[model samples]
Target: MARTRPTKRQLEGLLVTALYGATWWGILSSRTPFNWVLTVASGITAECVRHSSGRDRLDCLGDAFGAIGGISGDVETGIRPYTNGIAQTKTQIISHALKQLPMGESLQQRFLDRQGVNTDWFEGFEKRCAVLVGESKDGKTFLLKWRLQRFIEQHPDGHEYYIGDIDYGRCHEGDTPNTWFDSPVGQAVFTTADDIAAKVRAIAQDIRDGHDAAVPTLIILDELVDTMEDMDRDQFEQFMRDLKTIKNRGLKAGNITFVLGLHSTTVGETGIPQWLLRGVETIWLYRAGQERANFLHLNGKNIDECPKQLARLPRSFNGLRPCIVYSDKKLSVKAIPTLDFGNIEVKYSTVELSAIQQWEQDHWTPEKELTVLQKMREREASGKTPYSNRDIMPIIGIRQNQCVRSNEVYEHAKSLILALWESSKKSEG
Candidate 1:
């Protein structure tokens, strides 16, 4: 009869016995190095056999070792291992094993290498408004702030402004209290939505009348949807309209550019006007869906490609993430990087409340009040009910005042003038 091949179990048993015998002999001969070599060889041999036999290497090793008792015994003393028989911790072993694995470039490094844009792209960023949309927890805010920080570093002389929902809380990683607002190098940073709207109006006016400073202005509006939600419907719509107007005017004047961060869902949701969405010249989408793609005016072909690209993204938020970038030239998938600003301390100009109040008091003169009143009356007579502060501020020549806080000053002046007008009307009646 032909000799039958040994079964897998029988072969595994024979290999285990041979390894055990070799290990015991090595220990008895005081050859510690040989014992270690034998141990490694036994593991490798078992792994190979298991691979050939269609079994898990670890499972086969466990079975073989279990049948022969563990290999951790003192072979020289011929004593089985004791000490509660606890197995070696896998955590330490795995960690050490991982250290031996080949390392690759970091996600951020890989992304920057493949960005395909030159330094000129970042330098010319002030020419257009970029809107970044992403799902919640996809690090859209982080990436937005990173771009702002990069811009500030690249263009140190550029005036920057941050408009966001973060009033006093920590918004960035490792940010302490007031860090986000305190760090940005800007003419002024507005946290409240109302204040941001007023500042935008003032900036637009500055650009419109050729009064804006020669330096480029970088405006970062983080969580635009959140800011809009804080305002009433009418106020939100007007805010979007004002943003559109600012974008158009600023682009022509070459004075201001914006980086707006909003949720992917917010773009398609009601109450967010389409004109605001259309104002974006460059789009950065992070893990977006069809709704957001449609909102970006992406056709079906591009929309179908979005999910395919997003699916290949790694789930870690540790570094740069994949984004679908749509610009005036082309639409493509790209990686956006973030920065770690935890250790960098930035200096901010502190505005004393008393100084602000005093400045307003100084600028709010009787003559200015009379000028504002005359303009409002003119607009009222022309059938414009509830004249905007924007229409009234410039006519009062607030731009000529050389006030650093021109927006706040104009607002205070407008409120005082409106109150004065109401008082005069009541007295006349």
Candidate 2:
């Protein structure tokens, strides 16, 4: 087959002109200039039409002219807009990718008996909030705080936390209005029910809009008694109802949980309404010493055995013996052991505490104190003792004793030393 090529004159002339015009358009529009080889190679171009006042006809040679014109328009109108869109899209993709990544480590497997109970009790209950009411100093706050923390940690990508508390000492000085918007915990605020509905919506909107991360947020109403105490029964009922509304709305839209803590005198008083009780799923009762029975009653248990089972809990039970009751149609009781805060050398377990009580024939006596002191003096006399008074005090659980502050452990140790000295002197005589 025969083929024809453009003459060198035509190639060098029209193409050269087209290339120059295209290069001019590219340089004017670009942040970085066009390549030199492309400019030289594409120089030839068409000038097929004349601008005249007449009906236009398609030029037989308009393709080359149109191609040259298209290059200039694309440089001006298309490149920058397309590039910006791509950059924004990449940012969104990266953000979403980061969200899917898991936290560095999974939590250790510790059995939370009470949480398990609450899980079982609230199995079928929907549209509910738990009302924990009991004697002060019970582990209500401890358990509630722990569970809330665990829930948030588990659902890291659910919604951002929007915690609102009162303006107590905990709220910090210089905390201003809308200060929550600046909080890394995610737009938290300290406010009352007066404008809570609006503030909650605003915080929730920010989360939904993707401006904030969609992590499951906890709204803790600390000392709820302070706010709801003065309110009449109807008013209290209305407040509880409003919370239920927030719960339903917030949960459906994203992950939002509300936790409130109060004393029994407040939530159990005449100001509260009965209808509001239906909204709560789990009720935790915390009581210290002799109030365990009262706590049981609030959780829906009846006291059966009288004085025998009503014995006072040990003084060391301040942080011990975490028991739980589940709120189903009725409350079920479970007795769990206490946690021992001790060194490995003197680690006391619930079983060990009971054993020690049985061995002493009375529980946690100071009589063993005198005996232990005698042994320490013997060790010191023989120069076999390596540990000091500092080492000995904690072993007996008397170092940080709030009731008996040990400023001079040596004074206490001196008495034990004197007892041994007197006994040794008498034996020699």
Candidate 3:
């Protein structure tokens, strides 16, 4: 297409030069339809020539002369192909962006199936969320670690682990090999239930709204009872809502997978509802005992042999234990292996409650800041003070340069968040 149209003075000069001694009044004297058409066509041709480049401008001059003389056999070729090429290029870009985003069927699964990774361990789903439910000493942690190790090993493109509730006396706390700390992302060791919920909520939103490729992150949240122990009924409902949204929608992004561990599958015991559990694609039932019946019902199965197998399962602190695997309406008993983290030994430092870690800095937006401030406000209303500087920094997305001194974190954020809230309220009013 033409880069720039000519100015009024330039066009006037061009018309004068092209028409020789003929002026605007001279053309208007004809006052015929054919003359009016010629006038408009002549102006268009002149502008095209003025803005066009190289050989195209030279070819446009013949068309310009032809328009002035009212010739019938004039050819105007270059601009048509130029404009068409631009349109085609734009169409190609749009088509490429919409390739992964489908209108009818899901293209995410197709692309993942094309990747041809291992789903043998996953039961039914490809890389979606899974849950491990069993007694405390029933090797839930070890099996999850093994599955996660396999997930990381299978995806040669790399993966990360963000752990919540790394219990002090849990199986592999000191043994670093194949554990959550093996590839622990920056400050991702979540100590409190609140921090865990907040991070998961933020990540779910990112996966829902983002178009860029995310790193395949396996968020292993252990012991739901402990995680949601402090949340009241309303907060628990919101947390469940967030969890359900992510469980159903987060997996298709080809990243953002979860391996949540539950001590009991009963809704009353774990505070997790049947609706949420029914939606999970993969479930590992290890020594779940009475919870196995509820699990069986959720999967639309009533097999007698499943219970017999569950009853006969070994009950002791041993190696790998037999467990029931339910997925896609298929139920089978399989032995879950205990992961050996080898001779490598490392112990975690003392963990304090509500010690905030770094949230994703790049994805923090104005809307997210609003959410953070609201959370802070809730704590303030409850008479809960900010625990540490680390808590405020990650939640509010505060950079180091923003602070004048190290000692002003809690007080500064308290005053600032309240002020921002007031200002926002005024603006809305």
Error of 2 at 272 (Å): 3.3
Q: What's the TM-score of each model vs. the native? A: 0.52, 0.36, 0.49
Write down the TM-score for model 2.
0.36
Question: Which of 2 and 3 is ahead in lDDT?
Answer: 3
lDDT by residue (258-331, candidate 1, tens digit) is 88877653445635566555546444554353233343444446656654433323322234444666555555
lDDT of 2 by residue, 1-429 (tens): 011233333233324334444655444444533465454334323232222212121221122222322233244344644453432232123123223333201110011221222233432222234555434434445444444444544554443444444533343223233222234322344455433433444444334434332444556565566666544454455456556655555565455557665554223442444444434444434232223333333433333321112121111121233233334544443332333222212111111223322322221223344446566667777887633555454444445442243434434444544564576558769
Worst 10 residues of 1 by lDDT: 85-94
Q: Order of all candidates by lDDT, from best down to worst?
A: 1, 3, 2
Q: After best superposition, candidate 1 residue 153: deviation in angstroms?
A: 1.9
Q: Go through the candidates in order and give the clash count of each.
A: 0, 17, 0
What would the TM-score be for candidate 3 when compared with the true structure? 0.49
For lDDT, candidate 1 versus 2, the one ahead is 1
- Estimate, for each residue in 331-415, the C-alpha lDDT of model 3 and write its tens digit: 6555444445543322333223222212332333334555766765676678886333444555665654554555354445555
Model 3: pairs clashing at backbone N, Cα or C within 3 Å: none
Question: What shift in Å separates residue 257 of candidate 2 from its native position after superposition?
Answer: 2.6
